[model samples]
Structures are given as C-alpha cells and as structure tokens.
Target chain A: MLNPPEHQVAGHDARLGGLGPLADGSGRFFKPLQSCSRGDNELSFYTSFSSDPRVPPSVRRRFFPSFHGTQLLPASDSSGPKPHLVLQDLTSQFTRPSIIDFKIGSRTWPPSSPSDYIDKCFKKDRETTSLTLGFRVSGLQIHESGDAYYKPSRDEIRSYGHDDVRRIVRRFVSDSGLASAVYGGSDGILAQLLELKSWFEDQTIYHFYSASVMVMYDKEGVENGRSGPAVKLVDFAHVVEGDGVIDHNFLGGLCSLIKFVSEVLTDPDGEGEGRRMKAKKGGTENGK
Target chain B: MLNPPEHQVAGHDARLGGLGPLADGSGRFFKPLQSCSRGDNELSFYTSFSSDPRVPPSVRRRFFPSFHGTQLLPASDSSGPKPHLVLQDLTSQFTRPSIIDFKIGSRTWPPSSPSDYIDKCFKKDRETTSLTLGFRVSGLQIHESGDAYYKPSRDEIRSYGHDDVRRIVRRFVSDSGLASAVYGGSDGILAQLLELKSWFEDQTIYHFYSASVMVMYDKEGVENGRSGPAVKLVDFAHVVEGDGVIDHNFLGGLCSLIKFVSEVLTDPDGEGEGRRMKAKKGGTENGK
Candidate 1:
C-alpha cells in the first residue's frame, strides 16, 4: 500500500498568572500556532530571516539589524492607569494557546507528603508567571492503510496534502493581511506578553517540532526529502520563568521589548524595499 | 471564526483505520484503545457487551475467563515449519480500536542509554498487553477523536464515519477472504520464518505514544452521561531507535496478535459463549 503519514505539531507555552481572569483566575491565557521539531526545545524564538530573496545586502542589513543577543529589562518605567495600553494590543500578537501550570523548583523535589505536594504545586504556581502549556496540533495529508482506520472508500474523493494545506493557510494569512495585522496592529496585547516571555525564557532554543501524515501522491513534486507523509503531532511542553512573578512593574517593559522585536521580524516592507533599491544601485554601478 | 476542528469522531473505534492509504499508519499507530493519556501506554484490545441486560451476572463472571489470567499460548502446539498466526475478523462487536504490542518486563524510568531506552519501551509496550489481558476489561469504549481526525470535511464529504467504513471493510473481507484462504482458513500464519526472526532482531525501540481527542455529546435517554456516535483520531507519534529502523519480528508478532485478538474479541461464539449463556439465564431469573 502507498499509505503515507500526515504530520502534526501541537503544544502551548503560556505565561503563568500573567493573564489572570477578570473574575476568578479563569481567563483564557494562551493562543496556539503550528510548530515542528528543528530546535533545542521543539519551539523557538525568532532571530531573523528574509522572507523575500530580492533584498539588497547593505540596505537589508540596515533595515534588518540583528537582535540575536539583545535582552529586555524586566522592569519598566511605564506603569499606572495610563500605563502603556500598547502592552494590551501587543498581547494579541502572541497568539499561541496558553495553559495554567506550576513549575517544580529543585527545592520541592520529593515532597514529604501529599499535602506537601499540593503545597509545592500551589506555591510554585504563585511564584511562577511562566507556565508550561500543553496544546496539540497535527496535520495529515492522506489515508494510507487499506485495513481500515480513517480512510474513506474509493467513493470519497479526498485530496488532502501537507503542502496544499500549508499553502492554503499561508495564502490566507498573506491575503487576509493577518500576519501584518498581527505584526502592525495594536490589538494583540495578551498575545504579545506571552510571546515576549516565551522568547526571553528560551533564548538558546530554536526550531519547532511537528508531525505530518500525507499520501505519497499528495507530496508529489515538493522538495520534501522525507519518504512519506504520515500525519503525527509532536508536543512541546516547557517551563517559562521571568525575572519576577509578583512585580507588575515589568509588564509594560516586556511589552516594549516585544514591540521592538516584532518590528524587526514583520517589517517585510522596510527591509524588502531597502534591498530592492540597493540591488538597483548595485546593478547600475556594475554596468558603469 | 468557527473553524470547527477539521475532524470529528465516528463513535466506533474498530471502525476507524479504514481510510486505507489515507488512513494508513498515522492515526492507527497513535491510538492505544485502552486509555487516552499520551504518557501511559495501553494495549489495543476490543470489548463487546451483550444486548440482553439480564445476563449481566453470568457475563460478568465468566464471559471473559481470560480476565483471570488465562494464558493464551501460540495458536497451536505444532512444532513443524508452520509459524503461529493470530488472525481476527472485523465485526460489529467492538466500538473501539485496540492495540497489540509486546512486553517482557516491568517499566524502568529514565533509561540510561539508547539500548536501555529501547528495551524499556518494548517492555512497557508488552506490560500494557499483559495487564490488559489479565484484568477484566473496564473503561472499554470507542474513541471518538479517532473518528474526527479521519472524518471528511464538507469540502471533502466522500469521507464517512467508522461504522460505515467498517461495514464496507467487513463486506470486502467477507467477499474476498484472500488472506484467510491463503492460510487455509487458519488464523494468520507466519508468512515466512526468515521474516519473523529478522522482524524480532531487526526491531528498533520506539517510544510509542498516542491519545484521542473526543467530541462528547449527551445521549438522548442517558442523563448526565454522554454518547459519542462518531470518532476521529486526533494525535499520534512515536520515538524509535536506528534512526528509522524497526524490529520486523516484533512487528510481525504484533500484527498476528492484533488479528487474533480481533477475531476473539468479535466472536461471541468463541470461548465466551458459555459465560454469556449463563449470564443471560441468571438475569432472566432475577428479572434484571
């Protein structure tokens, strides 16, 4: 049988206690995005990359300055009622799903009793703003086994493929301007805070983990070196911690850091424009 | 944005894995019919309840004699060139998909090396089987998430639920009976001896794990409880040794066990017949 596997990737990395519920610690805390396994933590923070290949060197470099080693101060001067509402807007950009969980510090290992375990769990939860999130996302491109699983009979004209799905999602993101909106818009506040913490906590981690199940035919012509496309999801769960949990002062500061990072990542136009101009100048200079 | 999940459950576990090439190994391997947790590995086994409620007592007592640690030897005692085969026929008796794995020891944590990890994983897989086989099967229900992962979308409606899919497959198997005929109507046979040994030695340790996402809905007559008429597979993945290698012997043995288990699980007339009869009599006498 030419059954191929589909790929799927799912997990959530949320900030603990950061987005407390309006009433009773029940507010939804995280949003989720697709992921895969290509790094240390199976999830990664952005350094930089060029989406378009036509950008010129010097101009691109200026527009896309490296923030690889940059770190943001946890506490900020921005605070109070008039505190930057920009933080709220930026949170929406950090749209991966969030979960409420406690981190186990080394000191709490091997709790003395059940009550101790609960106490440890609760205390750790209170002191930790960075939470370990669990969310699963999987992708399947085809039904391969003949013995019977999810495969529709010959009558069902299913034509699912990973590339097709990716194209469709990406196309939708590009066409609807969601990426830009998320990058440039001021409504993703909750998301921004979570994203900021995730990146800050996992400075050394890169790449993401994902699984896919695809029929052989669906993967045709794609440069995927993998033999078959079978859908599967790899879950990435992690503990994220900040400089402090009780300090509300640093919230705005984290938001600002995220904004700076976001600008560099999403300013496709700025760097893209610079590169085009530089290429034109270079070409003319060479011609002379 | 009501992008209802891409898949839904089809109520019947055994009914899934019917997508053939489309349903191939992705969803099938990921579902461990016994439990839903990814961390806990459970064997793939099926359960069938009697239509007559009166027979509960007898059915409970002996319907599953195997539950009392019945040792299921290789299909036959023959020592000739014939290899053992466990063939199971698809039927309407089961509502869930079952697993067939192997175990040789207790679960050890934090495997020290690559080989240790593989050995532990294999033993855990086998242990699950041993436990399931020895205990009276409880919490035996179909997995709805298995159906959802495999369900077809409106844009791809040719996809049907697990029940409908199984019906088609059973019909196909009934009509063809080719695999059975090849073994002279015996349960699955060792297709080849060489393949079996190589299968065993060639086996790679895979940290196999699976979980199903169920869409639960309330049953019409049942209060407080829910009934899932549909199921779709949600997530599945594995970690194995040898880069991409697998032990052919273990796999072959597993396949045989699955086929055999399916046959016995579905066959009410098999060893479970006497117990079922007694249960019916007891229930009728007691007006239960």
Candidate 2:
C-alpha cells in the first residue's frame, strides 16, 4: 500500500453481482472494521499491513487483503471525536451468505461432513489422487481484559458433529494438475502466514499496543472453487508507538494469539502440534 | 560483531593498574559465556553495534561495549564442546567498585545514599542547577525454560547496607555544564537505548531467542570522573535467525523487563512512577 501506486479500483467479484445487493462485487470479503476486532489492534493492523516494508508484496496481497485504504463515516452521537474506522466493507452486508459472527473470543470447530469433499480431503493415508486444499478458517478474537485470555472456557470439544459445511463453503478439486497450477502448497502458505506473524513481532519493538487477531476468509469465492481462501488479519488500533513505547498491560497477548493460530493451522486434529512441527523438518519453507 | 571487522583489542581502562591476580586488567568484564546466554545474540549485538550503518559511532563504542570477538575454549572435562565469548569485560572486575549483579531477574532498588551526592542527585525539586547524568542500569535475565516469567520475589527492600565496596565506584557530579558536554541530555541517552532495543526487536524477526539486558560500567575510571558511565546491553544467546522462527514459549519477557527498567529508571523513588511518566513535558528524548 505504501510502495506501489494504489490500484485505481478494488478488484471486484462480478460473479457476486445479481446474487444480491451485498454482492455489489468488491474484491472478495468486506468485513465491518468495527465488528472485525475487539476495538484494540484495529488501526495498527491496517497501518502495519498497509505500510511496513518488511511485509513482502505477495504476503500483502495473497495472504492478506489489499488494504483499499480507510474512510471515516460521521459519528452517530456526534459528540465524541471518533467515527472510528470504516475499512473497505468485506462483509456479507447486502446479502446474508450463511455467516457466523462468532461469539467474540471463541474457536469454531472444524467442519465434519459425509460429503465426498471431506472424504477426499481428510483421508488419513496420503493418497495424492485428490491433492486437495483445506483452507482452515479460524482466528483469535480474544482480548486480554484482566484474566480473560483467549481460550475456550470449559467447553469440551468433539469431532463427531456431522455437518455438510464442507459442501457449503470449502472447494474440492479432483484434478491435481489444475490445482497445483492455480495454488501453492500448504507449506508455502504456512510460511507466508508465519512471515506475516514475524513481521508483526518486529513492529512490537516500538511497542504496537493492542492484542487481538482478526483472521478473515472469503467463503463466497472458496465455495465456488474460483480461488483458495486466505486467512488475513484485520482491525487493529490503540497503537501509540515510536515515542511512548508502552503496552498498558502485558504485551504477550499478541504472542499467545499468533502461536495458537500456528498450532491450530499445523495440527487441526486432537493434538499433533509437536508432530506437525517435526514433519516440516527440511526447513521446507526456507527458499520460498 | 557480524558486519564490521572485530576490534583487535577491547577498549581498556588505564586506571586499573597492577591490581593483582583478580584484576586481569582486561577490557573491563569477563563474563562466563555459558552463563551469558545461548550465544547467538551475543555476536549480533556486537556485530550490529560494531557495523550497522544506522548505529552512531558514539553509541557503537560508548553506549555498547566493543566486541573483542569469540573464542573456542577447551572444555574442562575435555569431552564436551565450549565456545567462550570474549566480551570487552566492562564490569568493575579489576577494582572492586560497588556494584549490584541484581540476582539475574530481580529489580533492585536504587542505592539510597545518605551521602551528599545522593542529596544533590536525588533532590525531588527541579533543581535547575545540576543537569546531572544518570546512567540507567537494568535488564531481563529469564532463560526460556518452559513459560517461566520475569519478576522479583517477595523479599522486602532496604536502603542501608555495609561492605568494603569501593565508594569511588559511583560518581554523582552536580555540575550541569560538564554533564551536558560529556554526555548528551538524559533524553538523548534514552532515545539511543530505545533505538538499541528496537534493533534487538528487528533481529527477532528471524527468531533470536533469549532476551535480556546487560549494562556495565567502570569502577576505577568513574572514580577519577573522566566520563559518565556508559550503559551497554550484554550477555544474550540462543539466537538462530533467518527462517527458524518459533517462540520456544511466551516472548513478552523482554518487553516486560525493558518496560519495567524504563519505569524504574524514570521513577527511582518507589511509587512516583505514575507521576514521573507524566512529567516529560517536552519531547526531550525523542526525534533521534
């Protein structure tokens, strides 16, 4: 966003047109910035992704949304000085697209389905027949308010809840050749995501003071097999960096959130974070 | 140091004469390498300070100690391997200068002296007469063992203690003109320190683990009052950069430690921390 000239117009998804008013077809998702975060880390997230040089171009566009810049809507009360931030609308605003505004600070479970897509993707044996891409969607909406950390509270999870959500959103392609041509391996994607995370850490040097993760993915495109969904961080603010290098409280909230995301992405099953980390033994993500 | 050529010899203290066996008359300090850190950061700190174009020469030499370079020593048992990092020993090693090792990870109180120096230096009022220099010495020493944190124990503090520690170790000169000439204002010193901290954070982008601060000064030399004691961050190891990005555990230990140090230094007299932070009316230590 800072280097190259801005794209004159946001890439629009014309396919979504006529589907509904919400489908006025902007480049994929249109998340409400206010609803995107827990009020913290919103501005910094946009500013960092929008400006920090360390964040490479590919990660900026592919892994994260192309920040279409920000806008300020008039305040409702008109007394306070904040209209807050109105980011490029990546929400299913005009049309309800089977969305789930998750209860703030909770991890939604993986989709379990009897559909052939899940069968092809979740096969324990690595049969390279499908060569599928599972863009697992999850994020840390948790905020560090006193002792309220980012974690499921007393809720035991189960893997047996059968659902057809796979058919609803995830895209499954049988042609391995075509899939390979269009999308990179999970290893590459994971590396990019991690690089983005590391970039975030470096910004903490001047002390970006907000702690919440905003991972968003466009289910509309992914469902139709047009593109592989991405996990992009959104909505960050309350950053007083450069001179006042202080995080009102403990700053480990960002570290904990990102680490959990890595764990979740690498090991979606019960608990294989250790094994999954070990599997990437060849410095698999280095050259990329 | 990584980029620039190593200094052939550590900057020496001419003041520490033939002070016997213990007084090796080395640069200033001789830290046990194993106890120093994991060894990765030690080199970078020196290399970065030694070479990075952004780091001013004064900061390179005065604020940070000169890197004498690394040495591989023979292990005592003669079986295991050991590489000793030969830092320019900056401790009051040769001259029994009154020093505080600060029990690795605890925040020790300031040396509340009843001496005339303390009275002059610690005067609460804005004594326009003495624009004194106070080299803040504080840092973190928590090893990445599980998720253990950095904080002091429940031991109560005291102001009075007696030992044969040389009184000449510390020099609290009240001359406003001399302090400004030798050392820039306190604001300048802080900006340099924060800049140094920022450099450390950038290196962490490649995952340099084990974060801490090590500040050292000269005892025999400061007694003569030739120069204000310089603050140097030392003894950090376990750093493997470039793509090996993984926080062994929580990573806020550094931020917490540094932030606390800034707090302690700014508010030396117990609970005035809140008030002191607000008193920086001007952008005194910024813009650099």
Q: All models, DockQ values? A: 0.01, 0.07
Instruction: Name the candidate that leads on TM-score.
Output: 2
Q: Per-residue lDDT tens digits of candidate 1, residues A1-288?
A: 101111111122112222111111222111122223223221232222223243344323421222222222221212212111011111121112111111111112121125665466435422322111111112212322332223222222123221222232223223323444332333342243344333322221121111111111122212132221111112222222211111111221232223332433355434532454456566332111
Best by DockQ: 2
CA lDDT of each candidate? 0.24, 0.31
Tell me the tens digit of each residue's lDDT in model 2 across A60-121.
Answer: 66444455544433223233233243344443221212121111111111122234643453
Query: C-alpha displacement of A6 in model 1, angstroms?
Result: 58
Chain B alone, candidate 2, TM-score of 0.40
User: Which 10-residue window in model 1 chain A sums to the lowest lDDT?
Assistant: A82-91
